[model samples]
Target chain A: MKRRRPFLLFTLLAFGYAFLYVPIISLIVYSFNVSRLVTVWGGFSTRWYGELLHNDQILSAAWLSLRIATMNATLSVILGTLAAITLVRFGKFRGRTLFSTMVSAPLVMPDVILGLASLLLFVTMEHLIGWPAGRGITTITLAHITFSAAFVTVVVQSRLSQFDISLEEAAMDLGARPWKVFLLITLPIIAPSLLAGWLLAFTLSLDDLVIASFVAGPGATTLPMVVYSSVRLGVSPQINALATLIVATVTLCILLAGWLMHRQETLRRRAPVIDIS
Target chain B: MTTRATINGSARNAGEWLGDLLTGHHGRRLVIALPYLWLLVFFMLPFVIVLKISLAEVLLGRPPYSPLWQYLEDSTVQIQLHLDNYRRLWEDPLYFIAYLKSLKIAGISTLVCLLLGYPMAYAIARTRDSLRNLLLMLVILPFWTSFLIRVYAWIGILKSNGLLNNLLLALGVIDHPLALLHTDFAVYLGIVYSYLPFMVLPLYATLSRMDLTLLEAAADLGCRPWKAFLRVTLPLSLPGIIAGCMLVFIPAVGEFVIPDLLGGPDSLMIGKVLWTEFFSNRDWPAASAVAVVMLVLLVVPLALFQRAQEKSEGKPPL
Candidate 1:
């Protein structure tokens, strides 16, 4: 493969990554610009960072977003784990096709359609059943769960399918109850993936704008909604500050996850060799 | 003694059967029913409602639509059907134009992502295992950040006095700061930048799994590198190319963020149109009609493609 000219390959990777990172790096740098003008940088200052802290609307929205995301992630995990287990554990059951189809439906569905459809559902259900009397945080969270559950299901299901089931069988053979087998043997083994799925859902919910906008009422502004409305006016250094903070936090988390994953990989490799010996 | 043993065996069989009844396929099926039922109630039912609303009259009311039924008695009801929403959608040139423009933009963006992502995915796929892991991680790590933030970052780069224009001005590429911010070009850039990862990951999946021996054989037979690539690599990686394109194109068609933020008012994507009609015009039925029409335009071809792919791959139809 190296016999083919490798120069072009290196150039493409360089340009591609430069395209991806330069915009982000510039955004971070401009966050500290002293001047109010975003395009030109005066000397470095933390004015925007200070401003961001004092902005109560953004702060409250961020808090609400965090609360909703936490709840959404938790619900998504529980529901997603259930769906994954069903698809993996149940064999040729009734409505299997519909279950699988619905599980993956939201992955590619347009947000406009999804949001519209769900909003319509809430409206009719509100009028007919008098449950969820209005769309707000509850409706938003449920709507978030509807799509994020699909994401969680995809993640957990893949991990579940790859899982070894003989351990559960062995536990069952030893007179463990069915629920006990699931509790002790299955859940623990897939816990890491469930964590990953939860994190994915959390990020997705936190970042969402379009779907949330559709379902959210006046009082239910999320962080993204606040940022979006602000951006519509003009780019602000405060938003840059927020973006920089988000990028840093995400980068740190990913690095930590990568390191942990690498360590686990090495441990698994070593343990297998020890067993063979 | 034989009769006593036989009786004991039969008794144990009955106990096992009862245990199976309590903790068997039937019980597991009920456990499975929970999420399935949740989706049936929430996900599928909403589409039904959307469909219902699309066929109803938009009115100023609590729910903002006329109900399909008027109860005259316990068993008698009147059914009212409205086709004006559909008819209006058919007559409106704006809706049709938005659909065409969306397809064009999405198609071009998919092409651009392919052009950029192919080489990157190829390079990563061809790298050694350790390097490949790191490269793949780098490609994916940015996605963990807020998508809105990522798109926002582009404003600083694409604005008149922003990074790209300033750099070009400094280099004397052009005398004036170009109108790079609010145009089809910016929209293209936004879509390509946002969706490049979607393209690369799928392509990498396919490319890495490719049997390199075929390429080696072609090389040994004195085939030129580019020809070998076309004959061997391209054909083998068609699945990835298709997957990546569909992933980018389908979502791009209904994309609201990029066009709303980056593209000018005339951008006219169906998503933006639907939103304006609902929020500004307060036309629930019209918006619903637009959504229904958009779903048809997007879903039907994809459904056909999915069925074809599943058949070819020998997977379960679902």
Candidate 2:
């Protein structure tokens, strides 16, 4: 009975994993399926991928999404890192609790509400400054930055809790200026966490549909927006192809990151042994 | 000696004090506080604006916002004034019903996730160390993909004449495709699939932390496996269950994408309604009101959940 129990557990675990990923698996498989219906099996072909490459609208939207994601991520990391350092290190003051809550509010706040608020902000800005006259890439990018930075702040702050301040103190004692210490020691130590936060922010900005849809004007159509409008009409194989590409790229990047981390750990262990020698 | 005396002047001490003020022990706090201020300006202030706008009357096609902004400039804007939007919300039964329906849907999906996630999490937790990491990785790998794409994949599966229907037809289960898409059932499935990982991680955290001897002790006391689970295991794991539910339910209530994509016309969740009011309808005032209400609904529960979590963590409930 105990032996049989292991087998049952294995089967259950396998089923659960399959349940989690089968839809995604099927989508990737069907992207290469020549058949139009996603359900049916057809001979393998890459025609959809070919079609995706040739589609101008899809390509442009993808470009726009990438651009916005990069900008949003960069801005988010800068702001978030600063905020994280302050909140975790400084700890308490007047309105500190309120400030912490405000920073994180965007993380849980409904996307629709965020979109409206951003739109309202834009309108108010337009009325006051007579700039950013309409919803465009700039507005969308700014909106993305708003929420993405908040998320990045949380990630960086959490990571900061694990950081040792002793290294910076040592650097300062060794005749480095405070800024120099931060740049050389603190930044390098926290770089991986910052990178992770940046990646998360980038992915979030790229994948945003609802907010982008709200703030996007004619020229600012992001990939998600394009995919959404297309999906609303009906399922298209092109979307399947696009999604497949994204999933593949993301999966590869994640695996690469993991491998790099593993290799770094291995090298670190080897370095200690070499030093002992 | 004279040069040294000049260099050690009081002005240098004053400058040092100013520099200390700028870069003190709390400098990091001041640096981090900048983002919080930005959030207060951009994120929290909008809610305040929403509250203010919700009070103003809708005149002609334009919203009554300018006057309210002016009223804010003056001392005449009574903070305690507006109950009309709240009153209207109460008078309209549909709004309340929509909130209830959303809660029910979110609740059921959260429950489903918990049921499915617990066993999976347990299996992963109990696995041999070598394989455990791989199993956990597999569980989290899907999360790296775009959530929207994952949800979109289900559309292909659930649509009439879709793969699931075709597979069933091929198996001679049914002659016709079932109306699976555009239904509350589909929305629930989507929610469960999306939120399952959230449920899994928390359960895994709690279960992994557990000492196996407690279960063994229950067994020694003549408790059966099921009884052991009910008595010892369940109580120990309630923290995880609560955490998982909060993680799933909080976001699920505000979910827009799944319902917007998979739900039918009748399945008008507040998220979709809110989206329309803000974007398509361009009724910012009404949209703000709805948003404010949603925020209120969420914040109260969120506070309660956090309080519970804090208590479990052995802290005074804030």
Candidate 3:
């Protein structure tokens, strides 16, 4: 208040954002640089991107990661939605406290604990039931869903708690069955949060390195595994390009999700009728 | 309607029965049980399995450890259990150092995050609505991207010949490239950089929702801005601060990627130790023991969190 300009605050804000964005921007810029050494910028070129496409290992790992992420996200949504529904719609169910603990526990559990435990689970299951054969994409997806679903449960639970129960009761009163009421009323209402949850789960699976590393076996190397091994050696231009592409895709998806959510909120404010559809 | 009546009445009866099975109390019960059952099998079972393995002795053969039970004739029973893993963990100085070191790093990084994040969160909270949304989006966008890649980005920037050093040299600020990468400082940087969003979001939520009138009232009472902030805003946002710190600290203690990527060989984190004990050392029992101990160590904080959540929700906690 004493000073006309809050220069210090502005500088801190700028520095914080710069600290956040500068590294990412640098990674993207160096991806375009036609040089073996990342420090030296030869010129702007798409040579690395071209090289990235030709790399078979990167391509296969990427496809594998995508398949796993999609499956993980879908399963997470199904399981987490059920958990959220149980908590919010079904009041005071048996084992409510235990259920809450289990649902929320994984949110803060370390990836190391999760990875080790799940790996042990898979190994023991294989010995007992001769199932899962050997760890690969299937094991990875299971490991991912275990944690991601907890996250989905949190997201969906928050949204569910805020929802007006009257709408669902109204539908039920109009001669709709419980399942029908849920399908016709609750599902549509929570679809945005569900989408957010799914996207969140997908991103989590895609980004995971430590857990996936532990669970994955032979011929099951994921994108992160590839990047991890490559990064351990050194930073290659190809990885930079791959990272830039990932950044672009993720930013686009997030912005789109934000826009969709904002639009839904605006529409809901304008007319409550539109929310039902 | 007449044509519908002509159809078999048993079909409608069956339909209702099926619908009842799908959407009735029993059906809802099934839906609730599905996730619970999954967690039981995957989450809870794993801990049990880890505990069991920790109790058993390591073996050379495939699948390693033998069954813990050995039943004999004449009503005699023997248990093939060993406390060697736990004993080893206690005997080894490395484990103690690693635990202490991890806590120190996690704590320091959490503090740095709070200092850095408070201003950013306040800036966003004080901004207009539209701009605030955009700024918040920017804060979260980094989170959407790969965390590993963000860590990797730090490697290039902090490398001796990388961008930061190059810029410093070109500006004549430093005649030589400093040894910035592969140090505890780099580990701190990586953790703080990556976990900043987690710190900012909760703080912003609390700060933005704070009633400005409280601060105004404090100012009217002859409180300076700093005093008003300490008296009013800080206390109000304490919950968020606690939450953000917990969120950052818990994961940081078990972080493997950041420390492994950015830290020097001297940086001994429990996560990395566990990884090596499992994979490199091939000591599954020891690794399981490490995990169990870590879980036990975390149980107190986690219970506190659950209590905090229950209090906020204003429910009778179980």
Candidate topping DockQ = 3
| lDDT tens readout by residue for model 1, B1-318 | 999999999997786665565457776766687788889988999988888888889899767788887888778989888989989878988889898999999999999899999999999989889899889888887778888888888888899988889999999999999988888888999999888887888788778878999998999999988999899999988877876777788889999899999998788899899888888888888899898888888876466435433332322111
Model 3 scores a C-alpha lDDT of: 0.87
Query: How would the docking of model 3 be graded?
Result: medium
Which numbered prediction scores highest in lDDT against the true structure? 3
TM-score for all models, in order of appearance = 0.90, 0.85, 0.93
Model 1 off-target regions past 4 Å? Answer: A1-5, A165-181, A272-277, B1-23, B73-75, B217-224, B304-318
lDDT of 1 by residue, A57-165 (tens): 9999999999999999999999898887777767677777777768766776778888888888888888889978788899889999989998788678767877777
- Per-residue lDDT over A1-65 for candidate 2, one digit per residue giving the tens place of the 0 to 100 score: 12124576667778788888899998899999998876677889999999999999999999999
Tell me the lDDT of model 1 at B189. Answer: 92
DockQ for model 1 equals 0.43
Off by over 4 Å in 3: A1-7, A274-277, B1-22, B73-77, B220-222, B312-318
TM-score of 2: 0.85
Writing each residue's lDDT as its tens digit, candidate 3 over B1-318 gives 766775657677787777789678788879889999999998999999999999888777777776677789977888888889999889999998888888899989999999999888888888778888899888988988999999999999999999999999999999999999999999999999999998998788788878998887888889988898898999988877876777788888888998899999888889999999988987888899999888887887677656554444422111
Ranking by lDDT: 3, 1, 2
lDDT of each: 0.83, 0.77, 0.87
- Residue A82 lDDT (model 2): 79
Model 2 misplaced regions, further than 4 Å: A1-12, A129-133, A164-181, A272-277, B1-26, B59-66, B69-88, B209-237, B305-318
Error of 2 at B308 (Å): 7.2
Q: Which of candidates 2 and 3 reaches a greater lDDT?
A: 3
